[model samples]
Target: MELLQLQYFLTVARLEHVTEAARSLHVTQSSLSKTIQRLEDDLGVPLFDRIGRKLRLNEFGNSFLRRAERALFELEQGKQEINDLSSPEHGTLKLAVTTASSLPNILREFRKKRPNLQFHVQMLNMQEMITLLHRGEVDFCLSSPSIYGDDINTQVVCIDPVLVAVPKGHPLAERDSISLLELRDEWFVGVKKGYGARDLVDSICESAGFTPKYVYEGDEPARLSSLVEAQIGIAFIPSTAKNSNEHIHYLKVEDHDLVREIALLSHKSRYISRAALEFRDVVVEYFGEMA
Candidate 1:
């Protein structure tokens, strides 16, 4: 089947609604439906189940969807590879990262070094980053505690100590160090699950024989700091998730502390593009010295 047809089928399968898929792809619903029908006829297997005008992938459709998605992803990556080879320094560099305090410095240095380089640096959650990398949407990813994939290669780059963020006038702010048990029962603004910092908090709190009162989550971890400053909560943020707000204070954890292992990830078998390699070197050099 044609690549376009495969794409259409994939979208319809994901959304489970031809109309919604058409809207997302900026096409007429009729045209999209016809395309899927054509694909099903050519394949001699029905790809979707129609239920009251809504569409969902059938058993065969589910299987086809996975293979089709992988094919499309490889095709796109091949195109990007060709483009990269034709103009090594000019093609786009798609990178993904989780929210970390060191993110700013890396962004700054990358921009400063290659001002003209095209880049799409996505700030995604850990699971999202893994999904994107596996799907070939991103060439590489950076995360904490190192995410593992079947074909992925990873290397630890930095060590992130768990730190407590409190309001400026809060009691813990005045202390140089605090224990996990001392903060038990306190309200906390949590990071999304699977994030390095969030895992650390979860582990530490569990060890203290108490669960935290989490009020918020997601990539914009600074919201937690804002909540802390407002006296709404406290957080066990990573050293990278800095307390940029002057109204908040950060205290180092004493003993029985948690630490996040920052890592760089890429598909093990994928050919390394020159630009990607260069960027990787930049990252390695920067974090290596810091460590």
Candidate 2:
């Protein structure tokens, strides 16, 4: 019934350990347990199934948890809306991104216009970004390959062409464009499998009848350019990230229309602050000019 009770219950459900949940909430274990007990009594049903020192959400708990989460999310959105009304120009824009290559430019332009607005940006994988969006943890998500959900809205900001980066002296470097099938025998340098670029590359390669033979796999997409420049391996680089490195040559994929869509995503029903709206506009305009 009480907001504190709901908060405590949610934390406990997430941690599934009374001691750990109590520690996280900075309250004593006994006090936390008493609070949970009171909540169950008021509801006339037990929320969690006891399992020694660990707790699991029962069927009743599962249903209540969803409603509790939405209730808290609405309350938080109301608070944020009031704050935004008080100071439209100053607030933190919480954002998550699957790709950050274009963010520096977009954020720089936004910062120039709204100097007082703050940013909390997280570099997350596609799934993590979607999860946070649904949880109302992030105001917006800058994603590649587009995220789709019933309550999620997406706007395509840019269609970034994926190009092959090869050492200038490589045999394929003489051509302005080449098919992925031709690169089947060549070793590649790319970000790890879970990355948006990597996933796109894999799908393209699979369609082209071969998987990429990676000589080097890393977490940093930026390193792909340098690795290819060293003749370690070739890589797939987005056109937006094109650099003037003399040792590297970027080739277009002649066989496949190799491109990824960069999208701005937000929850349809969530409240977006003025600063967040401005940030979104900057993202769209920045990419719009590029297109």
Candidate 3:
């Protein structure tokens, strides 16, 4: 029933391990357990099912968790509102992005406008970015292969064309554009399975009647271009990733829908600070001009 107890319960629920949650919350295991027990006692139902050292949320806990999260989110928003009102230029902007290629330009512009504003940025996969946005952990998320949810609002900031990157001396490097079918037998170096670019590439290749054969798979999307430059393998590189590297050839994809939408997302119900709103405007305007 107490606020601290609710905080402890939510942490335990999220981590699903008393010891780990305790460590995260900087509280002892016994204290966290007692707090959770108090919450369950007040609710008149057990919240978790225990299996050895692991804890799983039961039906009651699952139902309660949603309300608990909303409650905490509202409280945090109230705090943010007060902070924004008191010091508009000193607040922190929490953001997550799938790629940092275009972000430097956006952040540079934002910083020039509001040099005092702080930033907490993370480069996360699509799923992790969605989870953080849903949990009200981030102020805004810049993602690709745009997500749709009832509680989320998104705007397509930019449609970055995906191009086939090859080494300067490669056979296809001289072509103006190439089709996916032509690359059926070519070895590729691509981002890993869960990445937005990888998903788009795989889906397009599948539709073209073949699976991409990747000779190398890595988590860093930025490195794919370098890998292609080294002639390790060809790769699908976004227009935003087009750098001044003379050793790489970025050929357009011919007769295919090879593009990713960079989206700006925010929680529909979460409070947006003035700084966050300004940054969002900057991102929209920056990309809009580019388009």
List, residue by residue over 1-291, the lDDT tens digit for candidate 3: 899988998898989998899999998899889989999999999999999768999999999999999999999999999999999889899999887788989999999989999999998888888889999888999999788899999888999999888899999978989888999999999878877888988998999999999999988888887788888998888998888899988889887989999999999988899899999999999999888
Which of the two, 1 or 2, has more lDDT? 2
- The true-versus-predicted C-alpha distance at residue 279 of model 3, in Å, is 0.5
Model 3: ten consecutive residues of lowest lDDT: 220-229
lDDT of every predicted structure (CA atoms): 0.79, 0.90, 0.90
Query: Whose TM-score is greatest here?
Result: 3
Q: Which stretches of candidate 3 lie over 4 Å from their true place?
A: none
Estimate the TM-score for candidate 3.
0.97
Expressed as tens digits, the lDDT of each residue in 1-291 for candidate 1 is: 788999888778877887799999999998998998999999999988899659978899989888998788778768877987787767777888875567677767777766767878887777778777777667778877688878788977878787888887777778888877888767787777877567767877788787777777756765776777888888877776675688888888776747878888997756568877877887788788776
**Residue pairs of candidate 3 with colliding backbone atoms:** none
Question: Lowest summed lDDT over 10 consecutive residues: which window, candidate 2?
Answer: 217-226
Residue-level lDDT of model 2, residues 160-269, one tens digit each, is 99999999999988989998899899999888877787899899899999999998988777777889889999889999887899999989999898999999999987
